[model samples]
Target: MQQQMIDLEGPYRLLYCSSKGDKDGVIQEIEKGVSPNLADYDKRTALHLASCEGCTEVVDLLLEQGADVNSIDRWGRTPLSDARIFGHEEICKILEGRGGTDPVGLDSQSPCYEIDHTEVEMDGATLIGEGAYGEVYLVKWRGTEVAAKTIRSSIASNFRVKATFMKELALWQRLRHPNIVQFLGVLKHSERLIFLTEYLRNGSLYDILKKKGRFDPPTTVAYALDIARGMNYLHEHKPHAIIHRDLTPRNVLQDEAGHLKVTDFGLSKIAQEKGAYGYKMTGGTGSFRYMAPEVYRREAYGKSVDVFSFALIVHEMFQGGPSNKAEPPEEVADRRAYEDSRPSLSSFIYPEDFKT
Candidate 1:
């Protein structure tokens, strides 16, 4: 009996080779009579995968071999759209030159508040804030000042981080409450991920506390109500509850009207279930200082974690600042967990109702 030949000719092999940036493999497949425009189940062609992965040579080869430049995928995305979304500038230019069009448009049926990147003027923009993941800049859009949050290139390079950023943007766009910061739009770019939001002139709650030590009882009560309303809105979100894993003062901004608005949904989680235990969530997701005991222990927690953090914020309002400021944040969290240490509330500083 003759040995049977192992069959390997299929769209999957071609797609895999294209996705892995295997130029020689792609050439071999094309030579073996595989259509250059052959698409996978999702209608994603070799050109689409190559463009997404920034495989410049493979993209050129596919185009030269007669790959369709304007093929649309299952999600109404073209090869050019993937290139633009993934920040493959060269691939985008190449596709555009080949008459590729993003006719479906990034704004069409997308979660983001989309705007042309060129519309936002960054000339003479001021650096307003920064965190581990990105920087915030004070920029102008359509003659109005706005806060532009840009993810650092180093961090944005991670595919998972980009996905999370998009997911958070989707959640952010759906939120429309006075006590919550307004999301303006996302600046479409070929190389950067930039989000635009309303620029608050009064800065954050942390800055206020640092400048004035603490608010009076009446003011604190008002601010607390504002925060509570915002958090309540988040928890009561339709379809799913959004838990703000990080609810520190720094993430709360004060408006020119003296009203407080909850901002920064970077670490928020959408609870898939609204049961007694809520959704099983990841621990250590937020700032250690405001981290709930359950979260610090890497246990499954729920929306109550936000409540715990809210209580701490209330405590900070009465106490002027975080307790045990000299101690490291992790140590403070440890003390709170093991020793049940809490910031002392001053009888003179807070009203009777507040104390309760």
Candidate 2:
């Protein structure tokens, strides 16, 4: 296939190969004296295309072949900037390490720590959180505190669940954004998968809202912006966008700096044009009260569902209660959400133009 491409194209074989994610072909073409700095019609190099597609191997090959890492397309965006904006942290790291892009001012923080399981002190660990899939505990690792999620021992024998857990680990390991939880690492404790992460002493937004009532306008907007920015980064992510099919207040955690970082990827789906996964059960998935209509109806959904859920969250944040006065029956609730019914405004104090 690569040889066919190499023969089919004349001067721009390297760009074609990179665009096609043909790392070997790109290397061969470069070795054949094709300039690695060649650009396409829009002035985008193989590095730009590979970075946008999250073709890390191809990118590395290009850099090694003397490809200009700082090569910019018409938009003046660097490969490192594109990678960072699209949630490809490792790619950004590589670009930076190669002296292509400046990271001195960028918020690039990827933390990876290796510690023996025996070094983790679980004696003072306490139940911190829970979800349909697993349990979370606060434990001390290497004298620093962290949140540890334990894969249910009962499901240890479930092959599918185990596979999904490992998949989550793979995804989590690549994530490095200030608005997303930093995954420390994973450990095998008995029959459980213990996933460690940076612990936010400040609890979830759900806990704060329940205790303090409605948040002030500025505070609400601040938190909402943090979440929106995070979601935007995720949606524009390279290779595939991550749809947090479960974007509820409970999954949003606040840090000491008062910034919100999204947590949990169990129900996350890699957004694509088609073939997104969905369950066909009677009860809805991932907090129906905050679920998008498309998701509740078991229809094909993408990143927009998360935006819809965020709107619902903002509504609840203002209302200080559930979207529905009395949680409606499954059919009615589904119909209302699908029909674009807003929560009762008689009791909620919302800006008139909010729905607009």
Candidate 3:
């Protein structure tokens, strides 16, 4: 398949090979002295294709072959920019280590860029799980497992949403830690968003709790500690403090090693101050059951809101059911009153904490 692509016309072959994510073919073509910096009609080079495809091996090969990492397309986008905008953390790291280009800066010629990811072949890819957004399949890349999220066409729309999504992608690309789910890269097709990421085989904490009724104390404590550690990394990191407003069990995935990872930054925000947590009015978002009391009332809140949600998750882990189960009318009234009396940024203490 790669040879056929390489045998075709100039750089288009490289572009085609990169788009198809044929890493070996790309390396073969580059070794044959096909200019690693070759550009297509739009001035997008093979590096651009590899970066967009999250073909880290091909990208590394291209970089090693002296491909101009900073070469901007007609649209003024470099390989680094494309990798970051598509949430390809590994590719971004490679480009950053080699190119020294800024991923967050907007290209002058084109205010926006689009990724066209094809559906990777499903064979050999383990179907890990499915959700309202799409199906997540696990595949092996460079000897490591990666989660490939393929969203349907009906979910993606025009430039504005794409821009927002890319912004989030860039943010995730910059995140480097063990606890956060790593963004591998993106595969763009005419009508789909194929997001490749590090695969966590154990699935979500919610799944585990549901299937087992509840976790043993040690397991529950371990999960909570992992969650806290991840949240601390996000909230205390320099340059920008990320607030994961949605910290529900469903978003907390575990790996085979029993380590917890946080996923889905679609509702995350960057804090302006060291301890500040809330952002501008972006409307109510996140799962209702796990939402902070202040979030529901259109109030400004901060990192503590996540703490509150985390408290709720811990409560659920101990309760053996969903956190927002039916509450008596008096209890609901008391809860509402308590919420109204507290500051938006106040940390919520679980009732169980007092009982224990």
lDDT (CA) for every model shown?
A: 0.79, 0.70, 0.68
In model 1, the Cα lDDT at residue 312 comes to 86
lDDT by residue (271-329, candidate 2, tens digit) is 55333444332235687777677667776566778888888777777777566557654
Write the candidate numbers in order of decreasing TM-score: 1, 2, 3
Worst 10 residues of 2 by lDDT: 104-113
Show the colliding residue pairs in model 1.
Answer: none
Every candidate's CA RMSD: 19.6, 13.1, 14.7
**How far in Å is the alpha carbon of 285 misplaced in model 1?**
3.3
Q: Which number leads on TM-score? A: 1
lDDT of 3 at 329: 30
Please, what are the lDDT tens digits per residue for candidate 1 over residues 278-335?
4454545579999888888777778888999999898888788987889999998888
Q: What TM-score quantifies how close candidate 2 is to the native fold?
A: 0.66
Sort the predicted structures by lDDT, highest score first.
1, 2, 3
TM-score of each: 0.67, 0.66, 0.58
Question: Model 2 lDDT vs. the true structure?
Answer: 0.70
lDDT of 3 by residue, 1-356 (tens): 23322334554567667756788878777777788888753467888878875788888878888889898764356888777655689888989898548544753113223333433554667777774467888876545567877665555666676667667766775554446776656665544676777777788988888888865555566677778867887887556778888888888988766678888876787888887745743334666566676666567888887887787777777666663368543344246435552212212423454234
Q: Candidate 3: lDDT over CA atoms?
A: 0.68
